[model samples]
Structures are given as structure tokens and as C-alpha cells.
Target chain A: DQQVKQNSPSLSVQEGRISILNCDYTNSMFDYFLWYKKYPAEGPTFLISISSIKDKNEDGRFTVFLNKSAKHLSLHIVPSQPGDSAVYFCAALVSGNTPLVFGKGTRLSVIA
Target chain B: EAGVAQSPRYKIIEKRQSVAFWCNPISGHATLYWYQQILGQGPKLLIQFQNNGVVDDSQLPKDRFSAERLKGVDSTLKIQPAKLEDSAVYLCASSDGKDSFQETQYFGPGTRLLVL
Candidate 1:
């Protein structure tokens, strides 16, 4: 079963515009959520993360909002750049020692 | 600091053949993990190791897959009599393993395997 899901397969946004990516999970036990960005022929790179305790976390132009009641989360990139075009994977951690469960990923394309 | 290092960025082999992939985690990182990512899908954890000891291997297909981490530094994952379905990108990741609350995993470029 897919514990995590990203409904959108792909997205396109104009450069300098806001880009929003969404994710959902079926497991309520997950306490931490993370977002990773990946380029072609490379591994995923960490982007932003949010703890269950907090509803939102922000790092520079990136912000992650978590809604516990909905078991959903989202990543927002403001003023998106061309470099921001990549596959974004949403991952969750149930506990400190457990492995991360990842979503199918959303491919974002930024056009200038 | 350098990120995780994986060998043989790409490998192609036929069915029933054996192949091995290696990884070198970042300096002083105690926790290591291996993942398999199929096309159009997210990565799935195959195994996790904490300082040369296994922490989790529930997702690993032990019948054809095996992994080992020596001296808590480097690790190797091997597949014997590989099948066509085994084709995927093998990713290696590492974390500090000290603080779970703030733990961040670093991943390598990954080794892509194609079984014909």
C-alpha cells in the first residue's frame, strides 16, 4: 500500500511565481515530514521539513505547512527560479529510528 | 564536506547475473541506509544500518539481496541471480544518528542498474 501519496504528477509555473506542491499520508503515526528535490541523474537533496508539533516551518523562500487533522502537507516556493524545476518527493518519519516513507513525487517545471 | 559516495554510477547486466554496489558515507556519520527506486516511483528503503549493525532490513528481499557494512564506515549491497524485476536505481544515504529530532540524511548520486 502507498502510505504516502502525491496526487499531482507534474506542475508548471512561471519563473518568479509561487510554486505549490502537495502531499498526503494515510498514517497518523508519522510525526515528521520532509521535502526533497531531485535532479536528473542525481540523488534527492533535502529541502525543508516540519515537525508534527508545529503547523508550519519556513526556510528562506521555502515553507512547509502540516495539517495533522487532514494528514496532509504542502511545500511552497516563492519566486520560483529555473533551478527549482525538479522532482519533489515528500517523505515522512514515524519515529526517530524508523525509515522514511516517500511519496511518488511531483515533477515541477519552471518556465522563464 | 563531501556527500555520500557510490560506485559504478550505472550498471547493465542480464538476468541471473550477479552485481555488487558500494557506498562510502560522509565522515563520522554513524547511520547508513540503502534504497531502491523504480521508474516513476519514490525510493523504498531496503535496509538501514547503525554503526555496522543492522537496525532494519524488513523491506529487503533476502532471498536474492544481501548487504554488509564493515567497521561502521563503508557498505556494500549485492544481488545474486538478479531478475529482470530487480532493475532500479540503488541509492545510499547517511545521517548523524545522534539526534533523531534534527536528523537529516544525505544521499549519493545513486547507481542505476538495468537488467536485460
Candidate 2:
């Protein structure tokens, strides 16, 4: 079973526009959520993360919104840049010692 | 500081052959992990190590796959008698603390393996 799900396979946004990516989870026990970006042939890099305690967290141009009641989360990048084009994956930690479970990634393309 | 390092960026082998990948984590990191990323899929954790001892390997195919961290610094992953479905990218990640629940993992570029 897919514990985490990213329904959108790809998303396209124009430069200087807002790019929003969404994710959902079936397990309410997950306490920490993370987002990672990956380029072709490269491993994933950390983007932003949010804890179950908070509803929202913002860093610079990126923002993550978590809704515990719905078991859903989203990542928003304001003024998307062409350089931001890459695959994004949403991950969740199962417990204190368990490895993180990842969702099928969504590829984002920003056009100039 | 340097990020995680992986060797043999690309490897091609026939089915039933043996292949190995090596990784050198960021200096002073205490936790190490190996992951498998198939095409169009998110990465899956295969194993995790705290120092030279294993913390988790339940998802690992222990019958044909093996990993070791000799001195709690560097690590190696190997697959013997490989199968065609084994084609995937192997990623190595390291964190500064033993508690992965609270720490960030730094990832390496990864090693791509193709089995014929």
C-alpha cells in the first residue's frame, strides 16, 4: 500500500508565478514531513520540512502548510524560477527510528 | 565541507553477476543509510547503520544483498547474482546524529546500475 501519495505526476508554472505542490498521507502517526528536490541523475536534496505541531512553516521563498485533520500537506514556491524545474518528493518519518517513507515524486517545470 | 561521495557513478552488468557500490559519508557523521530509487519512483530505504552496527535492514533483500560499515565512517553495498530488476540508482546518505527522526540527511550523487 502507498502510505504517502502525490496524485499529480507533473506540474507546469510560469516564471514569477506561484507553484504549488500537494501531498497526502494515510498514516496519521507521521509526525514529521519533509520535501526533497532531485535533478536528473542526482540524489534528492532537502527542501523544507514541517512538524505536526504547527500548521504552517515558511522559509524565504518556500512555504509548507500542514493540515493534520486531513492528513494533507503542500509546498508553495513563490515567484517560481526556471532553475526550480526538477522532481519533488514528499517524505514522512514513520516513527523515532524507522526510515522515512516517500511518495511518488511530482516533476515541476517552470517556463520563462 | 564536502557532501556525501559515491564511487562508480555508473555500472553495467549481466544478470547473475556481482556488483558493489561504495560510499564515503560527510566527515563526523554518525548515521549512514542506503536507498534504492527505481525509475519514476521515490527512493526506498534498504538499510541504515549507526556507527559500524546495523540499526535497520528489514527491507533489504538479505538473501542477495549485503552492506557493511567497517569502522563507522565509510560503507559499501553489494548485490550478488543480480537480477534484471535490480537496475536502479543507489543513494547514500549521512546525518550528524544517531537520531534520524530529528536530523537532516545529506545525500550523495548516487550510483546507477544497469543489469542486463
Candidate 3:
């Protein structure tokens, strides 16, 4: 059974627009969540993260929001640039100390 | 501040052959993890090491897959009599091992394996 799920497989957005990627989880014990961005032929790199204690966390153009009660989280990127075109994986862990469980990933393409 | 390092970027072998992959984690990092990522799927945990000790290997197929990190600084994964299903990208990652829940893991470029 997949503990985490990314319903959307791919999304496209024009430059200077906002792109949102959503994720849902079935495990309620997961308290820490993270987003990783991966380029072709490279490993996934850390993007942003949010804990269940907080509803939101932001860094530069990237923002992550968590709705613990609903077991959902979303990553928001404002003024999306072409460089943001890649696969995004949503991951979560239980008790803040377990190995991450990752979703299939969402491919986002930002057009110029 | 060096990231994780993996060797044999690409490997191809016929069924029943043996293969091995190596990994070197970041300097001073105490935690190491190995993952297998099949095409069109997310990476899955294969094994986890904490300073030369095996912390988790539940997902590993011990009958054909085995891993060791004797020195705690580096690790190697070996598969004997490989099968076609063993084809996948093997990724090695590491973290500082200080934070309980907020630590960030750095991943290596990964070694792509193809079993013919």
C-alpha cells in the first residue's frame, strides 16, 4: 500500500505564474514532511519542508503548506521560472525519525 | 562540504552475473542510506547504516542482495546471480545524524544498473 500519493502526474504553467503541487498521505503518524526536486540524470535535492505543528513554511520563491488534520500538503512556487521544470517528490516520516516514504512524484514544466 | 559519491555510473550485465556498487558519504556524516529507484517510480529504501552498524535492512532481498559498511565511512552493495528485476538506479544518501526529524539528506548521482 502506498502511504503517500501524488494524484497529479504532470502539470504545466507559464512563467511568472504560480504552480501548486499537492500530496496526500494515509498515515496519521507522519509528522514531518519534505519536498525534493530532481533534474534529469541527477539525484533529488531538498526544496522545502513543513512539520505538522505549523501550517506553512516558505523559502524565497518556494512555500510549503501542511494541513495535518486533512493529511495533505502542498508546495507553492510563485513566479515560476523555466528552471523549475523537473520532478517533485513529496516525502513524509513518522515520529520525526523514520526513513522517508516518498510519492511517485509530479513533473512540473514552466514555460517561458 | 562534499556531497555523496557513487561509482560505476552505469553498469550492464546478463542474468546470473554478479555486480557491485560502491558509495562514499559526506565527510563527518554518521548516517548512510541506500535506495533503489525503478523507472516511473519513487526511490525505495534498501538499507540504512548508522556509523558502521546496520540499522535497517527489512526491505532488502537478502537471498541475493547484501551490503556492508565495515569502516562506517563507506559502503558497498552486492547482488549475486542477478535477475532481470534487479535493474534500477541505486542511490546513496547521507545526513548529519544529529537531528531527530528535521535533518536533510544529500544524495549521490546514483548508479544505473541494467540486467539483460
Candidate 4:
């Protein structure tokens, strides 16, 4: 079963605009959420993360908002840049020493 | 600092053949993990080791897959008598095992395997 899901397969936005990526999860045990950005032939790099106790976390131009009641979360990038174009994977971390459960990923393209 | 290192970026083998992939995690990292990512799908954890000791292997297919981390460092993952369905990118990741909530995993480029 897919514990985490990213409904949108792809997204496109113009440079200097805002980009939003969404994710959902079915497992309530997950208390940590993370977003990773991946490029072709390279490993995924960490972007931003949020804990269940917080509704939102911000890092520079990236912000993650969590809505526990809806079992959903989103990553928002304001003034997106071409360098931001990549496949983004949303992952959920279960409490304790456990591996992350990842979603299918969403590909975002930022036009220059 | 050097990132995680993986050997033989790509490998091709026929079904029923054995294949082994190697990984060297970032220096001083106490936790190592192996994952399998199929095409068009997200990565799935295969096994995890904390300082040369297994922390989790519940998702590993022990019947055909085996992994080991020696001396609390570098690791190796092997698949014996592989099946066509075993084709996927094997990813190695590492993190400091100090705190679960603050830990951030760093991944390697991955080793892509193709089984005929």
C-alpha cells in the first residue's frame, strides 16, 4: 500500500512565480514530513521538512505547510527559479528508528 | 565533505545471475540504509544498519537478497539468483543516528541494475 501519495505527476511555472507541490498520507503514525529534490543521474538532496507539532516551517524561499486534519501537506516556493526545476519526492517518517516512506514524486519545470 | 560513494554506476545481468553492489557512506555517519527504486516509483527501503548492527530489515527479501556493513563503515548488498522483476536502482543513504527527529539522510547517486 502507498502510505504517501502525490496526486500530481508534473507541474510547470514561470520563473519568479510561485510553485506549489502537494502530498498526502494515509498513515497517522508518521510524525515527520520531508521534501527532497532530485536531478537526472544524481541522488536526491534534502529541501525542507516539518514536524507534526508544527503547522508550517520555512527555509528561505521554501515553505512547508502541514494540515493534520486533512492528512495533507504542501511545499511552496516563492519566486521559483529554473534551478528549482526537478523531481520532488515527499516522504513521511515514522516515529522511532524507521526508514522513510516516499511518494511517487512530482516533476516541476520552471521556465526561464 | 565527500558524499556517499557507489561503485559500478550501472550493471546489466541476466536473470538467475548474482550481482553485488558496494556503498561507502559519508565518514562518521553511524547509520546506513539501502533502497530499491523501480521505474516510475518512489524508493523503497530494503534494509538499515546502525553502526554495523541491523536496525531494520523487515522489508528486505531475505530469500534472494543479503546485506552487510562491516566495522561500522561501508556496506555491500547482494542479490543471488536474481529475477527479472529485481531490476531497479539500488540507492545507499546515510545519516547520523543520534536523533530520529532531526536526522537527515544523504543519498548516493545510486547503482542501476538491469536484469534480462
Candidate 5:
């Protein structure tokens, strides 16, 4: 019963290219979505997030787009760098207090 | 400015053994969470604490898993009579105790457990 799902298990992109990671959710109760990037030995680090009321949020090189009607969200990293190679997990929750439901994660590999 | 802290970065234990993992959230953050990340899978929430009180622990395996936050700052998760499937990276995360939708959770390096 995975409420959040990342359909792609892996993605490969060239350096300086744009990398897009997609995630879908079945639960409409989830109003907040988050993207976390994780390196090989470290815990998942918060990258970006969006709320149900908004359609897009961007910070630096990362941008997140949310479509409530589609129950979908995506993270776009422009000009991908080698350092961006890592497993990215998408999570969703109704609010801050509730535990987040996470996707299995998509491993992104940026070839240099 | 320090991130969440976890100790004993790596541990190897046998089946039926007992193991404990500790976590220290960031200063002034009142929310703490413990998650289990198996290989090729995302982190699964085991428990969450807000100011020493449990917010959620529904997914916890109560029979073998127990956790406590004595002072509301640091927490410990223990698994008694562990099973091989219990081997995974235990992650501790924290966030500011706010009721907003923009809160971001900070994570620790994580403690990797290998049950043999």
C-alpha cells in the first residue's frame, strides 16, 4: 500500500543537462510534497518542497512542480552536475505533524 | 547550526541479539523521528516524538522494537531478539516544532545495522 510512488528506479543524464524526476501519489489527503536527495552513506537531505495550493517552487538550480488534479509532482534540476548523482526520494504528508509517506526512491546518475 | 547526530555509524549483530541506536536532534528542535531504510528502499518511519511525547508509532514492531525520549532532546531505539530482516540503516531526523506546511526535516548520517 504505497501511497507515494516513484515509477522510475534509475535515471541517467549528462552533465550540464536537465534532469527531471517524477513522482505520483494516490492519496488526495496529502497536501504537502517534499523531495530529498541522499548520497551513498548519508541520510536523505531536504532539497525542495511544494504545497497543495501552489503549482511550482524553485530554489537555485532545483525546481519542484505540483499538479493537484493529476496527483503528481516533479523535481527538475537544470544543468545537472556530478555532485547531483544520488538517490532522490519523494515524500508526502497531510501536514507537518503526520509522518511522511515516502516513495521507494529513484537513483539519478549524472555522467561527467 | 549542527545537523542531527547519530552514533555508532555501523554495527553488525547476529540474529536474536539485541541492538540499540541513539539519536540527538538539532538544538531547539522539538520534533524527532526515527526511520528504517532497507537497501533499495526509502526510509520507513518507525516512530516520531514531539517534546518527549509520542506523536506516532503505528508502524513500529512493538514486540521487538521499543523507543523512548527521556528528555525530549535525545532518543534511543532498541530492537530485542532481532531478525535478519531487521538489518537496515536507521535514520534520525528533526524539524522545528511548527504547525506550518513548509517545515523541512534535517537528517543525520544514519546508523547502519547488519544482522547476521
Candidate 6:
């Protein structure tokens, strides 16, 4: 079973606008959540992460918000740029010692 | 510092043939992991190791798959009598320690295997 799910397969947004990607998980044991960005034919690169203790974490123009009660999280990018176009994956981990469970991923297209 | 390294970026073979992929983690990183990603799907963990010892392999198919990490550094994954469903990109990643809750993992480009 897929513990993490990204309902949207793809998303499109115009440049200089906010792009929101959503993810949900069924396992409450997961305490750490992360987002990774991947380009075609390349490995995934870590973007940002948030601990379950906090409801939100921000890094530069990227922000991650977590709702433990709902078992959901979202990533928001402000003033999205064309360079932001890529596949975004959401992952969750029970701890540093365990392997991460990933969502199917969402393809984000930022139009110029 | 160099990131994780993988060999044989692409491979194609007939079904029931044998194939192997290699991976070298970042220097001084003790935790290594292998993952398989199918088209339009998230990556699935195949195996994990901590300093030459296996931490998890619950998802691995023992009948056809085997993996090893020698000297606590590099690793190899082998599939004997590969099946058509085994066609996917094999990814390697590494972290400084087993507890990666706070540490960032580095991933290699991955080896794309196509089984006909």
C-alpha cells in the first residue's frame, strides 16, 4: 500500500504566481516530512523539510505546512519562476533511522 | 565533495538474463540505500545498509535479488533471471548516519534498466 499519496499528477502555473502542491499520508508514525525536486534524467535533489513538531517551515521562497490532525502537508512556492518547472516529490520518515516513504510525485510546470 | 556515484547509466537485456548495478556512496557516509522507481510512480526501497550491515530488506525479492556492501562503502545489486517487471531505474542514495531524520541524503544519477 502507498502510505503517501500525491493526488495530482501534474500542475501548471504562470510565472510570478504562487504554486501549491499537496500531499497526504496515512501513517501517523511519520514525524519528518521532506520535499525534493527532480529534473528529467537526473537524480532528485532535496529542497526543504519540516519536523512534525512544527506546523510550518520556510526556506527562501519555498514554504512547507503540515497539519498533523489531517495527516496532510503542502508545499508553496511564491513568485514561481520558469526554473521551478520539474517533478516534485513528497516524502515522509518516521525518524532519521528509517527509510523514507514517498508519494508518486507531481510534475510542476511554471509558464513564463 | 563528490556526490554518490553509479555505474552503467543504462542497460538493456532480455528477460531471464542476469544484470548487476554498482554504486559508490559519498566519502565517510555510513548509510546507503537502493531504490527502484517505475514510470510515473514513486521510488520504492529495495534495500538499506548501515556500515556493511543490512538495516532493511523487507521489500526485496529474495528469490531473484541480492545485494552487498563491501568495506562499508560501495554496494552492488544483482538480479538473476530478471523479469520484465524488473525494468526500472535503480537509484542509490547515502547519508552520514542511520538516523537521517535531520541529515540530507545525496542521490546518484541512477542506472536505467530495461528488460525485454
Question: What are the RMSDs of all candidates, in order?
Answer: 0.8, 1.0, 0.9, 1.0, 0.9, 1.1
Worst 10 residues of 3 chain B by lDDT: B96-105
Clashing pairs for predicted structure model 3, backbone only: none
Please identify model 1 stretches exceeding 4 Å from their true place: none
True contacts kept of 2: 0.75
How many pairs of residues collide in each model? 0, 0, 0, 0, 0, 3
TM-score of each: 0.98, 0.98, 0.98, 0.97, 0.98, 0.97
Prediction 2 global C-alpha lDDT: 0.94
lDDT of 5 by residue, B1-116 (tens): 88999998999999999999999999999999999999988899999999899989999999999999999999999999899999999999999887655577889999999999
lDDT (0 to 1) per candidate: 0.95, 0.94, 0.93, 0.94, 0.94, 0.94
> Model 4, range A1-112, lDDT digits (tens) per residue?
8999999999999999999999999999999999999998888898999989999999999999999999999999998999999999999997675899999999999999
Write down the TM-score of model 5's second chain.
0.97
Q: Write the per-residue lDDT of candidate 6 for residues A1-112, one digit (tens) a residue.
A: 8899999999999999999999999999999999999898888889999999999999999999999999999999998999999999999988757888899999999999
Which candidate ranks first by DockQ, i.e. highest? 1
Question: Order of all candidates by DockQ, from best down to worst?
Answer: 1, 4, 3, 5, 2, 6
DockQ, prediction 4? 0.75
Say which prediction, candidate 3 or candidate 5, comes out ahead on DockQ. 3
- The pairs that clash in candidate 1 are none
DockQ of model 1 vs. true complex: 0.76
Which regions of candidate 2 fall more than 4 Å away from where they truly are?
B98-101
Candidates in order, interface RMSD in Å: 1.3, 1.6, 1.3, 1.3, 1.5, 1.6
What docking tier does model 4 reach? medium
TM-score of chain B of each: 0.98, 0.97, 0.97, 0.97, 0.97, 0.96
True contacts kept of each: 0.73, 0.75, 0.71, 0.73, 0.77, 0.73
lDDT of 4 by residue, B1-116 (tens): 99999987999999999999999999999999999999889999999999999999999999999999988998999999899999999999999888865578899999999999
Global Cα lDDT for candidate 5: 0.94
Q: Is candidate 1 or candidate 2 better by DockQ?
A: 1
CAPRI classification of candidate 3 = medium
